[model samples]
Target: MSREFEFAQLLRAYRKGILSEKAFEEEMTRLEGGACGGFIAMGKTYASERDAIVAYLQRVRNGEAAGARALEQWAQVCKTDCMRSGLRTIAEREAYHVRVIDRKLNDLGARCEPAADPEIDRFVSMQSDPNISDLDKLRRITSSFANADEVVKPIYEFVDLIKQDLDAKEMLALWAEDEYSSIKWFLHACAALGGAAQSPADSRHEAMASAQTH
Candidate 1:
C-alpha cells in the first residue's frame, strides 16, 4: 500500500482507539523515516481532522510551518527518550553543567573585574539548586549571561559546546520507548542555542540596539 493509505489506516486506528497515541506516533515515525519522521508522526498522531495529517506533513516538508512544528515534536520525542534511557534527569544534567560553566565564568569575571550583576549571582546559585527545573536554570543562565558584557562570549561558547554534543535524532531514539516532556524541552533548548550561535554578531547588535532603546 502507498504511504498515504498506510497513514490513513493508522489514523483510523488511532481515532477508533485501537492504537494509543504513543504507538501511532511510533509507527508513523518508523514508516516515514529520517528527521522528517518526527514531523510526519506528529502530523499523523495528533491530527483530528480528515487529511489534517497529510496537509500538515506537506506544509512541514515544504519549508513552511513544518520547521517549528517539527522542532516542537522533536523536543517531545527527546524528552521521552531521556526517561526511557535511564539517563540523568535533564534538571540534574543541566544543573551539573551550569555549575561547571558558572564557576568558570565566575572566575573569569573576577579576574576581569566586570561589574557585578545580581542576576548573574542568582543564576550561579540556581545552577547548584536541585529544586529548580533544568529548563528554568537554563533560562536563568542565558539571561544572566546576556546581562554581562564580558561573559557573553564565554557563555555562548559553553552553550554551543553543549548543543554540539547533542544528537537530536539519537536522543529521540532513546526516548522512542516512551514519551516525556523534559526531552522535548531539552531539544528545544539545543535548537534555540544552535540558532543563536549561527548569528551571534547579529544578535549582539540587536541586543545592543534594544538596550539603547530601553
Candidate 2:
C-alpha cells in the first residue's frame, strides 16, 4: 500500500481506538520522516491486532450472553407494553450476538471461556423481578450508561482496528450499531416515562410503541 494510504489508515485506526496515541505518533513519525521500525502492538494487554480483536470478542460475547438472559427475564416481567416489546427485541438481538461471536471465536480456533460476572447477575435478578416498575427498569438500564456513546464506543473502536478479519469487522460494525440503537431506544423510553433525561423524538416513540401491538 502507498505510504499516504497507510497514513490515512493509521489516522482512522487511531481515531477508532485501534491505535494508542503513542503508537499513532510513532507510526506518523515513521511515515513522515521515513524512519525504519516494525509494527507496534495495539493494546496494553494484547500483543497484536488479532489478539486484541479476539479478546474483545470474548468479552463482548460474555456480556451479551448475560444480557440476553437478563433481557429475556425482564421482558417476561415488564408491565409496560412498549418497553416490554423493545426488551424482547433487544433480548433476541443480544442472544444472536452471542451466537455470532461464538462462531467467530470458533473459526479463529479459540476456546470459549466463561467468565463470572457478579454485577451482571445482580442486574439480571433486578430486571426479572415482577415488582419493579418498567420505568424503574428503564432507569436502571439507562443509568448504567453515562451517555449513548458510552454504550458503543468500545465496539466501534475495536471494529476500526481490525484489518485482516473482514468478517469479524463487519459483524462488529453491525453489532455496534445494534447496541447503539438499543441504548437510544431505552434512553428515549426512559425519558418518555417521565424520567430526568431528555426524551427522543415523537417518531422514535411511535415506532417503538407500535411494536407492542404487533
* Model 1 lDDT, residue 73, Cα: 30
Sum up the clashes in candidate 1. 10
Name the TM-score of candidate 2: 0.74
Off by over 4 Å in 1: 1-111, 114-116, 141-187, 190-214
Model 2 lDDT tens row, 1-214: 4567888899999999999999999878866543343323334545445666677787778889888998999888887776777789999999999999899888878856888889888988998999988778888988878778887887777777666568888999999889998898788887767665454557666565555347
Model 2 bad stretches (over 4 Å): 1-45, 199-214
Clashing pairs in 2: none
Per-residue C-alpha lDDT of model 1 across residues 1-214, encoded as one tens digit per residue: 4568778999999999999999999988866652243322332433222132223223322221222222333334332232223223443443343343334334333212224456544544554454654445345434423323343333233223221123322322332222233434333343343423323444543443343334
Question: Can you give the TM-score per candidate against the true fold?
Answer: 0.19, 0.74
